[model samples]
Target chain A: MSNEQDSVSDILEDNTYKYGFTTDVESETFAKGLNEDVIRAISKKKEEPQFMLDFRLKAFAKWKTMKEPEWPNVHYPKIDFQNISYYSAPKQKKKLQSLDEVDPEVMRTFEKLGIPLDEQKKLANVAVDAVFDSVSVATTHKKKLMEVGIIFCPISEALKEYPELVEEYLGTVVPVGDNYYAALNSAVFTDGSFVYIPPDTISPMEISTYFRINTEETGQFERTLIICAENSYVSYLEGCTAPQFDTNQLHAAVVELVTMENAEIKYSTVQNWYAGDKETGKGGIYNFVTKRGKCQGDNSKISWTQVETGSAITWKYPSCILQGDNTTGEFYSVALTNGHMQADTGTKMIHLGKNTRSSIISKGISADYSSNSYRGQVKVGKNASNARNYSQCDSMLVGDKCSAHTFPYIETANSSVQVEHEAATSKISEEQLFYFESRGISRENAIEAVISGFCKEVFKQLPMEFAVEAQKLLTLKLEDSVG
Target chain B: MLEIKDLHAGFDGNEIVKGISLTINKGEIHAVMGPNGSGKSTLAKILSGHPSYEATSGEILFEGKNLLEMEAEKRSLAGIFMGFQYPVEVPGVNNAEFLRMAHNARRVSAGEEEIDPLDFDDLLSEKMKTLGMEKKYKERNLNDGFSGGEKKKNEILQMAILEPKLSILDETDSGLDIDALRVVAEGVNKLRTENNALILITHYQRLLDYIKPDFVHVLSNGKIVKSGDKALALELESQGYDWVTTAN
Candidate 1:
C-alpha cells in the first residue's frame, strides 16, 4: 500500500476498533469441543424444560446427520467442531440489576461504542439490551415498556417467564432444522433478546440490542424472536462487535419474526465484528446466521435492512414470507467486504398470498482482495395471484483485484404476477476521480463521498443512530481495503 | 495572470503539445482555435493538471506560483477551473450538495467563511437563474440525465459559482444550441471581472461572437502558428482552419 493509503487505513482501523476492549468479568465457560454429550450438558446447564430439551436433542440429531453446506461461494479451512467452545457467559451477569450494577469494563465497552445504557434510559424513548457473550447483562426501559402490555426481556428469561408464548411460536417459522447454521444454533444456543408487542399498540420508541463476543475459541449462538400482534408496530435494531483475534471464531444465530394483521416490523442490523489480518488472513469470525420474518395476516408488512462490514466470512440472508393477502415486504442493504473478507448476503421474498408485493435494493462494495455477492430469490406461488415485485441489485468494485457478482433467481407460478429485476456491476472510473479531485476535494474524501452516495438508498432505511455508524463503517471498510 | 513558458507536454512521450508559450492578463479572454487533434484540448487539460498529461519540460506560473509542482486539487484550490467537454456523472450525489462541498473546499483553503446550507441554497438559486436553469435541477444527481446543452450549462453554472481566477473552457460550446450558447456565454461574462481570466478553446467562431476574445491563436501541428485580434475568429469562420494551414 502507498503511504497515503496506509494513513487512511490507520484512521479507519482506529475508529472501527474503538470498542475492542477486554473486560475482567468472571465467567463460566464450557470446554472447547463439541459432541452430543456436550449439547446435552448445555441443555442441563440451562435447566430447560423437558419439551425444550427434547427439541434441542432432536435438533442436535439433525445437525449431526447433516453435512456442512458447500454452496455459499466462500472458501475457508475445515471447521472442526471439536475445537470450538459452544457456550460462555459472564459470571457477573447473574448479579446485574440496573445499568449501575453492570461491570464497569463492560459498560466502558458500550461507552466506547457510542452507546451509553444510562443515557438511553434517560432518553425514555429507546429500550436497550446489552448482550456480552452468551448472556444479556442489562436491559433498560423495562418499566415504560411493561406499562403498555409489551414484554421485552432476554430470551432465557422470557423462556422461563412466558413458557406458553415461547412454546407456541418458538421454531414455528424458522424451525431448528431449517438450515445447517440454524440447526447448530438450536442445539447449544445460550442467550439473545426477545420482544413481544401487544395488539392494538404502536411501539413509542425503537428497541435495540447490542451484542459483544469476547471469549476466545468460543461461539456466540443468539436466538432473537419477535412477535408483533394485530395492529401493532415495532422497529428493532441489532448491533454486534468483537475484539481482534488471530484465531478463527464462530457465530451462528437465528432470528424469527412474526407480524399479525396490519402489523409492521422493521428489523435493522449493523454488524461490525473484527476482520482478520489483511496480509495472511489469519483470523476473524465465520458468521453464519438465518433470520426470517412471516406476515401471517392481511395488510401486514416486514422490512429488513442491514449494514454489514465485518467478519472474515459472512453468510446471512434475512428473508420474509408474505403469507397474508395485500401484505408488503422490503429489503435494503449495503454489504461491504474488505481485506480478505467474503460475503454472500441477500434476501428471499416468498409471495404466498394474493396481491403480495416486495422491493429489494442491495448495494455491495468490494475492495482489496475481497469478494462480495448478492444472492437473492423471489418465489411467487400459484396462490400469489397478481403479486408484484421489483429488485435492483448493484455492486461497486473499488480496486482492480476485488470481485463482485450477482445471482438473482426469480420463480413465478402465477402468470399474472409482475416481476422486474435489474442488476449492474461497475468500478470507480479514473475520470470520475480526476473530476472530483480537480474540484479541490481530496482523494479520500472524494471516494468517501461517492461511496456514501452509492449507499444512500440503503442507509436511509436504518435508524438514525445506526445510520451514522453505518456510514462511518462504510468509509472505514473501504479505506482499509484499498490501503 | 497566467504564463506558460515553452510548454512541452504529452501522454507517454508522444508530445501532443510540442512547444507552446502564451500569457494572459487577469481580465482578458483568449480563444485558441484549431482543427481536430491540433492539441488545443491537450493544452487545456495540462493547464488543469490532468494526471494523464506528462509535461516533458515546461513552467506554468499562476499568480507567480509554480503550478506544475502542485497536485490537481491543490491547483484547483489555487484558483483554476476547467469546463470539460463531457462532464462526468456522479450518481446519487445531489448537484447542489456537490457544488457546495467543492465551493467550501476552496473557501476553507482561502481562509474565508465557509458557506452554510441556507446561504448555499440562496447562492445556487441565483446562479441557476443566471444560467437559465430550472430550480428543480439542483436536487437531481449531478449530470445523471442531463442533455448535452444542460450538461454544458451546468458546467458553466459551476464555473460561475466557483469564480476561479483562471477558467479554461475546452470545447464547452461543441453541442450547445444558439440559445444555450447565449445563456452560457452570459453566465461566463457575468463571472468575468478584473481579477479573473478566461481561455475559450473552440474550433468555431460561434462562441466568440457572444463573448469576444482579446487574442485569437490558430494552433497547427502542436504549436500556435498565428495570432490576431477578434476579427481573426470571424476570418477563421468565413475561411476554415485549412486557410491557416495553407497560409503557413
Candidate 2:
C-alpha cells in the first residue's frame, strides 16, 4: 500500500501543467473596476472611431441590465467584476514594423510556447497573430496574405485600417447583448484576430492566433471575427494558454464567423489554459466564451472543431445558424477535464433554411474529481423543410471519482425535419488496463492509445500540425488521471 | 524454461490455485485439463501476473527470474504471453497498430530498433496470411464488434506478432467453431519451435486432437491430480475426470 501511494504521488508530481510559468515583463494595466470612464479610456488609448465607442457604450448599458446566468453545470465563488482589471498590455514605446521591434522578453515567451513569430523561425505556410495579455504583439506573413486580397491582422489594427468592414460584420452573427459574458466582452474586449477573405479566392495559407495571458489579476477579453466572401474558403486556428495563479482569472472571449454564398469557414481551437492546482483547485482560468458562426448565403458552410483541455470552469458552446438553403454546419469537439476542473460544453444547430444539414460529434473525458457535461440543442424552424441533424456525445471516465452528464434539447416546428441524438458513458476499467499491460504496453502508453483513439474523429477535423499538438497535449494531461 | 512450486494464489482472499506445482520446458507443450471451477483459469492468470490474483506463498521462476515480482507488462516484456479466453475489446484502437506497439515493446526491451509502420505492415500481412485471416482485420478496431471466433483468431494473430518464449492459452478453443478452431490451432502449431514452450488450458480434449501435447496434467481443487503423456488426455476424454479425481 505504501508503494502504491508513492507511485500515485510520483504520477501527480510529473503531471504538473508545463505552461504555468509567467513571463516577467513590464506591463501597463488599467485600474481594477469597470465603468464608462474605463471604456472611454480604452477607446481613447486606441484612438477608436466614435461609432466604436458608441457600440461599447450600448453594450455596457445592456450588460449592466443583465445578470450572470446560473444555468451552467458548474459551481464557483461569485466573480467580483469590480476587482478585475479589464485591460492589460505589455508596455511598448512605439509601433513596430517587424518582429525586430517587438520586445525580446515577449518574443522569448512565444518562442518558448513553440509559436515562433520571428522571420527566420516563423512557421511556413501559416501566418500567426501572437497576442499577449490585452494586445496583439506581432503578426506573421502579412505581405503574403495581403497579396491574395486577404486581411489578417489584430482587431485593433483592423479597427483603424478597415473600420468599415469591422463595423459591417462585427456583431452581426453574435449580437452585443447575446449573453452576459458576451455582452461584457463586447463592452471591454481588448484585442483578438480579424480575418477577411475575398471572393472566389482561397487563402494561400492557414491563419492562426496564439493568445497568452500573463498579467495575474487582469481579465482577458478577446473578440475574434472572420468573414468569407462569395466562393471563398478559409481555415483559422486558435491556441490559448495562461500562467498559473492562485486566484482564478477570467477569460471571456467572443468569436463570430460569417460565410457568404458558396463559401466556407473552418475554425479550430486547441485551448490549454492553466487549470488551476490539481489538488486543492485553488487557481485556474474561468473560461466563459461565446462563439457562433452564420451561414448567410446559399450553399455556404461553417464548421467548428475544438479541443478543450483546460480552464477550471469552462462554459462554452460554439454554435451555428444554417440560414441559407443547402447550407451545412458542423461541430466536432473533444473536451477533457481533470483535477477539480469542470466543463459544460457542446454546440447548437439552428436550421432555418430548406435542405440544411448539421452534425455534432463531441467527446468528453473526465478524470480525478472533475465534472463534464455535454449540453446541445438542435432546432428546426417551420420553414426549414428537409432539415436534418445528427448528434453523438460520448463520455469516458478515468476513475470512479469523476462524473459525466449529457443534456440534449431538440425542437422542431415542422414535421419534415429529422433529428437524431445518441449518448454513451464508459469507464476505463481495470480490466482494460490489465489487458494492455499483459501485452507489453506500459500503462501510460495504453491510456494514450485509448484516449487518442477516442478523439480521432474530432482530431481529424483539425489542421495537420494542430492535430498532432492536440494529441500530445491530451496524452500529457491524462498522465496522472488513471491509477 | 518455467517452474512453479507450491503456488498458492487467489483473489479476494479466497485461495483458488492452492498448492499447485508444475514445471514446463522449452520445446514441450503441456495441456492442463480440468472441469469448471477447478482453478484452470486461476493458474493461467497467476502465471501471467494478473493484478487481481495474489500469490500468497509460492514461487514462479521463468528462466531463473522471479516472475512473481514482475509487473504484468514487465512479464510480457520478459517474453511471457497469455491468450485470454475472453479477449478484451478495445474500441477505436486499430488492430494492426496495437500489434505493432506490442511488437515494438519487445524490440525496445531487447535494445533493438523499433519497426516502422510500413515494415510492420508487411510483417502483419504475412502473419495474417498464415492465419487465414482477412485483410480487413488489420484496419478494424481491436476486437470491437468481433465475433467470438474472430476474437480467438485475433489472439493467435497477436501471438504470432509478439513471438513470446512462453505462451499460455487459457481455454482458447472455447466458443470457437470447428473452422475457426482449426485455423487457430494451425496458427499456434506453426509458431511452435524448439526454443519456445506452450501451455494450453482446456476443459475438453478436442483441441489436443489438432496439436498433440507432449505432457498432460489433470487439475482438481487447485492441485494437479494426475500427470501423464498424450495417452492421459485420450483416457480422460473417454472415462471422464471423475475417475482421475477419485484415484488421486
- Chain A of model 2 scored by TM-score: 0.98
Best by the TM-score measure: 2
* lDDT of every predicted structure (CA atoms): 0.86, 0.93
What is candidate 1's lDDT per residue for A91-152, written digit by digit as tens? 66444566777777777777677667774434456788888888887787887898999999
What is the alpha-carbon interface RMSD for each candidate?
3.2, 1.8
Tell me the DockQ of each model, to 2 decimals. 0.47, 0.60
Residue B122's lDDT within candidate 2 is: 96
Q: Chain A TM-score of each model, in the order shown? A: 0.95, 0.98
Off by over 4 Å in 1: A1-26, A119-124, A442-445, A480-483, B5-21, B33-39, B54-58, B106-119, B134-136, B175-183, B203-206, B218-228, B231-248
Over A120-200, each residue of candidate 2 has an lDDT whose tens digit, in order, gives 999998999999999999999999999999999999999999999999999999999999999999999999999999999
